[model samples]
Target: MRRKVYTKDQILKAAYEVVENEGFSGFTARNIAKKMGISTQPIYLEFKNMSDLKNALLDEICNHLYYDIFPEVRTGDTIIDLGLSYVYFAKEQSNLYNALYVQEYGGGKKMHDFSYNYFHQLIVKHPKYSKLSENKINALHVGTWIVVTGIATLMSSGIIEPTQDEIVHLIDRTINTVLQEDDTSVLDSL
Candidate 1:
């Protein structure tokens, strides 16, 4: 009898399929083996442990997001288009989205940190936002992120199915409300 052989790339690809289809809950040695149509021994041979495999999977997901997904999501409006694209990605890739966003998979770096950094860059690139103070931009980013993430969660979970127009409206309202910031209740009390 000959032993079956599998490459590291093959193993990682299978692991990605498992995570994409079954979410993080399905990210196990057994699932990867089943996806690859092989035994678990090959997985152990290719990687040190599940953590190693998971890190590899996270890298793949990030690559897909940056190179494959985000590129297709672009529209004229950098901010609204990004939000819409995020929502679309969640709907299209629910299981993958859950693994990346819902599950704690980044090891040391968290999903929120990644989002904040991305938003920071987006803010800096915007003509209107370019002159704003860093603190104001950060506040606006938090506000917009909250709304966008909430929408993505709802769409991913099938709790609500909003139209593209609705998503745009929501993002607009959120950004406007946060950026306006006229009322100062804290100072009123003081």
Candidate 2:
């Protein structure tokens, strides 16, 4: 019998699907083999180790988050839209969210740092935040992300069922409080 062959893309795609359905713990060579109907030897041949495969899967997940998920969250406001999108992402993809943020399965940048970096980049891109200093922007991101993550966790855990409007109001209040002084001193206390 001829040995089965699997492309790198096929293996990575299978791995992503396994993780998407089974969370971070589900991403294993055996699972990918089962998903793709191939032997684990093909997976091993395609990837040096599980870590390598995980990095590839992380890239795929980031792409999904940035391209597929982020675009759908819009409210004519960058900050609000991103916040809503984050919460919605948690609700919709709780397993992936927990794996990326809570479990740190990607093993590279933590979601907290990623969120901070994302918020900074987002702030820089918008004219409204052009005048703000880096520290102030960092403060604002931390403050607002706290609220966003809290709402996401609650919703994802099924502990609470807040509507989108209520979430928007909470985010607005958090942003206002963080930016009210328009100074970096608030960041010191945080």
Candidate 3:
């Protein structure tokens, strides 16, 4: 008997549903197959193994993370708005955000590089940053990422239950600190 073929996208859609409903803990080949309404063998036929399917899911997640959030980073806009949007995206897609960054997965390359490169590029685009050293820009990027990630984890773990207003204010402080520091420098040096 010929094996039935499933499209790669079909498997990804099913996998996303599995992630949404069951999370990483509850998803498995059986679950996906049930969701797809087909035998698991078709998944095996389409993908070499569960890892292949998962890597594809990660790719889609990466795309969603980048595409959905990139508009805020682009537009040559103010950095403060960009920082706030980051938190908003994290809050809105908490599940997908945790899945992309918090979950353990096989392909280390995609896990580490795909999302980060865009983040690095975004930091380089900051308007006030052109006058700063590369090290300073890199530090700002890393620090901003740390702030958002820490807040997301804290919110998810229930460690720091910040109101939405508090989160907005905190993000505003982080972004405002950059210019405040720049503006507060010794004016006599100019």
Candidate 4:
């Protein structure tokens, strides 16, 4: 049968949509091609293998999450709102969230490391944290992983029955206690 040709962008987009709607386990060249109304050959021509396709998808998800959501999270902003937004994001984009945030689709240890580095850099950039030594920055990396991951995990798992406001407060109090700082909008000044 003759097949339609899809661009690299189209295939990657279809792959992401498939993962979001069908979950990571549902991801495959066949399904993606079906969604794109094209053939697997196009994907093969664009990518070395499925891992390459997934890695591309992961990179795209990382870019979207970091630029659209993570940067918008102001430390000086309402902790409740931040927590609410996080939960909302998870629920709203469950499939992407599960794939990028939860699912072990393609060995996401590097993704985790990237997240850890991101927060650590943010902390280092903050005037409050700038005074801290290298050890302090390292400590913040560990601290952020423990706290933020815990919050994200809780919301993503849907096991904790907490309201947005309550979750915000919980997250705020936890971060505040650890940082020993009252300000929430740490990103604005920088």
Q: Judged by lDDT against the true structure, how good is candidate 1?
A: 0.77
lDDT by residue (7-91, candidate 3, tens digit) is 8899889989888665676568899999989988878888899887887788787777677765563334444445556556656
TM-score of 2: 0.88
Best by TM-score: 2
lDDT of 2 by residue, 1-190 (tens): 9965788889988887787678778878888899988779988898899988888777776777667776564676678888999999999988777777766564336456656767787889889887887777878887887788899988989999998899889988887877776564655477
What is the overall TM-score of model 1 with all chains considered together?
0.82
Per-residue lDDT tens digits for candidate 4, residues 1-190, read 9756667898888998898888878889999989987778889999999988888887887777667866665446433333455556776666666676677664267567766666666665676666755554555445444555566666667766665566666666655654663333342122
What TM-score fits each model?
Answer: 0.82, 0.88, 0.72, 0.76
lDDT of 2 at 139: 82
The root-mean-square deviation over C-alpha atoms between each candidate and the true structure, in angstroms, is 4.0, 2.2, 6.0, 6.1
Inter-residue clash pairs, candidate 2: none
lDDT values of the candidates? 0.77, 0.79, 0.65, 0.66
Q: What is the lDDT of residue 68 in candidate 2?
A: 77
What's the lDDT for candidate 2?
0.79
